[model samples]
Target: MTEDTLNSASIGAGALLSVLREGPARTRTELVELTGLARTTVSQRLDALLRHRWVVAADASTSSGGRPAATFAFNRAARLVLAADLGATHHRVAITDLGTTVLAERTADVPIDRGPESTLAWLAQTFTELLAESGYDLADVCGAGIGLPGPVEYLTGRPVNPPLMPGWDRFPVPEWLGERLGVPVLVDNDVNIMALGEHWGGHWGGHWAGYPEADQLIFVKIGTGIGCGIISDGRLHRGAQGAAGDIGHIRVAAADDEVVCHCGNTGCLEAFAGGAALAARITASGVLAKDSRDVVRLLGVGDPEVVHLVRQAGREIGDVLASIVNFFNPGAIVIGGDIAEAGEHLLAGVREVIYKRSLPLATRHLRIQASKLGDRAGVVGAAVMVIEHVLAPQAVDTTVTV
Candidate 1:
């Protein structure tokens, strides 16, 4: 059913479902105690969820000394979501359950410059293949989330005059994909999803417990282009026009040589420190490096010049970030993308600059580190977006009917 056509339930039912989804399996009595709902209201909502198959009966709780009470659990397998992370030169797709458990995934070297029609067609075909391989049908998918390597008007799910994406300005991505997939679609900036992925415990072998105390975070991506994802007070901050963390376009005072950025700006941070800049510098030095990956390979082998350039780029990025730290006072800064593969050299440079420039109050509790999820961050974040949206109280009410 279409999102607009689905029936909705009372807010009380939605609230009850949310509690079951987040907490341990609970009986009717426990739900009443947690939600402050009357016993009859809890029973009514539970019956509605059971009718929609959004929740299922579980084994009785054995804690009470008398008769065991029947419990209910959120039915994670009742629906699925498709997630895609579209990069400048590569892309990844995955199928996940409602709980964000990935069942299948695939990566390919598809370029975004190929435009939306060609790239999205390939994505649809690949998704079909992935679902078949994983023994799931198209009807099982309730929604999809896509992350693009450009500025997006999140409300419309359309790219807004993206510099690197030609012929994609104002493309109706959600309508196009939703029509083909027969599910609602959500879209956002790639780095935004990466930040969400990192925060949702999708990093470090997919097992980070997350920092409960540090509610502010900055995720910087230093690849073919540069961007950042900002989280403030435990929520993604998209700003007034969904361009909150566009740090790459910010001018840096440390840039000595004039470099023209693709956005037709000179002395931009991306021009001085992004992957393309590093690749150009390396190729100009008689090295046949094709992209940032080659530069990372050189750095891995301890190439002194490559290492030096990467570290210098880190310092430049950190220079821009120090001002951000002073203004935002984020507790953590996570570096991601191909350039971050340089590891300690990059982190050391960033730490040095941030620690040296920022005030003591800002830097005192700051934690700077490399992204543990690497390239997987975007896809995982996309999955998380779909999961959160699909399970939200309003969305759940719309999707399920009693």
Candidate 2:
């Protein structure tokens, strides 16, 4: 079916499907109450969904009281989504059901510098293997979502002049992956998806709970690079050019530091506090750390130098973030990435600076801490991206017609 035909179809089915997918809708009466649809329209939409096995009937006895009305739930097994989290030094791929339940997942040390063609080819093969292991066929895939470690034009799913991702600038990621998987592909910056993952995983509770209340949040990833993801008014805030959270490139006011950034800038926040910077600092200090992971390992062994450097880096990051806090006034800030694994050292420095520098009003309600989902945030967020898009009202309408 053409896009025009799909859009022109009756929207009743989409509405019903969306409601049912969120949770079980017991009885036609309940669906009517929830969707505000007439009984006849509800019946028509239910029939269409049932015919396609997109929904299934639960035991009638499960319903409370009256004449045991039939209950229906979204058929999560009917389709799958492929989610990939591609970082600078590592990647993860997973196969998830329509409901975002991961069935199979694999992690590897694939570098993005291998370029899009090679990296995507590896992902394609890995996705096929993941599906096979999960006992699902490639035909069952409804869509795919990937998170790249750089700025991306969300609409086009293309990296835009990414500093660390050599040869990936303007790469047609969605087109390349979609053609290989034979499904719609969505892509976004890695940190953005990580924020989505953390938000969806209920990491924004306590200080505030759920959307809207927890909407004003910031996710800072201090890995090989430093970047942030902003959530405002219960939605991811990608700037007009999809660079809203490119905090790594922001110049810091540290007068004594003149470290050069990979983006060819001096004294940027990432140059002073990112994983690469820490690793380089450790190496230059006559330590044998190879990368950020090594620095973390040294920190684990109580190396005072590594500990001091990490804490200082945290302060540097927090110094930059203090301005962000004053500006955005986010309720929560989640810190993630390789260095975050060092635990309190990083958090202490960040908290110390943010609380001391930001205005009292902003700092009073702010809750800053380590990431809850940790390394899995990206993959889970990628899955969320696919699940959300595929289950949207318009997307469901198009799918039903197709």
Candidate 3:
């Protein structure tokens, strides 16, 4: 390694831990060489990590001859994270290792509008059940993350004036869950966590498997409402007030003025294209579609009118996303949620408008595709969010010091 390169590498225990997380194992000499730190300095950092069980020494040696050299690897199983994906109509909870691998998970139709106290009580109980099912306990949990289907004040982990989430305004989500779970809790919008899951956790393999690794990506969820999560330079961009991706409420150009939105807006994109809106349209057509899931089921049954409406809904969503594509110029846009599960018709409409309306430079390398993870995206993303926060450099340093 170059002297300048060696000089630039951080020599902290957290820095070393970050390298170890990249996989494989390294000996103390290799760690010194890679981190560009003195042998004694490397030993000190490694000792701290080993003491905290953040890194473990392999039993085998990596030596050609003479004294055996010990190897160290990041202990991905050192802690667990409890993650919950709470939608307006459904919720899911999971227990994952530090690596974001789901060890145990459960999903139910418990609605979010049940109010924070009741919903969170159910969540806390479910988390306990999942941990025990996974052979772990609250003590093994490092942190918890939740993705709500509404606006959230990310810094405080509280919902803020969410339209669909009645009785959840300014609710202390983190505090309520943390008090029960005995760990730090983090909360964010459902689509944001889906974006994180689409970006960080991928147990599903499909055509768009390659998109999650993109540094700049957009994840659009078209369920009861339409929203997006932006990934800029490989990190979630929550904007000021954690409301950056509330694309559904944006006024749609040339939208029907008569279409009313739950937020009391007349021309909002969600009023025209969201799942609830589509379901209402289906109901008007004499078909019974309770929600977005019903819309997908109707699409499965080849209901011609539902198909037409879903495609048109996709077009309306695309109309709004075209401007987003031009402005953000993301590397990829992943489509998810119940409406998206309606299949390729939505994607076709979206691709048609996006490719036609977006600037050439933006469209040149942009990929618009379906979410591989599908319904599991939210829960997986929730786990990933917790894993990143719990194992962050500052958190790691604090853990070692503590």
Report the backbone clash tally of model 2. 0
TM-score of each: 0.94, 0.93, 0.94
Scored by lDDT, model 3 comes in at 0.86
Give the Å shift of residue 154 in candidate 1.
Answer: 0.5
Pick by TM-score: 1 or 2, better one? 1
Which whole-number lDDT from 0 to 100 does residue 43 have in model 2? 81
lDDT (Cα, tens digit) per residue for candidate 3, span 1-402:
122343425546776787788647889888777777789888888888988889998866747786789888989888888888898898878888887777888989987888999999999999988878777889998889899999999999999999999999999989988888889999999999999998775323334466544668899999999999999987899998899999999998888889889999899999989999999999999999899999999999899999899998888889999999989889889999988888799999999999989899999888888987888889889888887777777678777852
lDDT of 3 at 278: 92
Where model 3 places Cα greater than 4 Å from the true spot, the runs are 1-10, 59-61, 64-68, 202-213
Q: Name the lDDT value of residue 396 in candidate 3.
A: 80
* Candidate 2 per-residue lDDT over residues 83-180, each given as its tens digit: 99898998889888776667899999988998889999999999999988877878898889899999999989999999879999999989888888
TM-score, prediction 2:
0.93
- Please estimate how well model 1 matches the true structure, expressed as its whole-model Cα lDDT: 0.85
- Predict model 2's lDDT versus the native: 0.84
For residues 277-391, could you state the per-residue lDDT of candidate 1 as single tens digits? Answer: 8999988888868888888998888888888888998898999999999999998899998888889998888888999999999988788988877887887789888888877
The CA lDDT of each predicted structure is 0.85, 0.84, 0.86
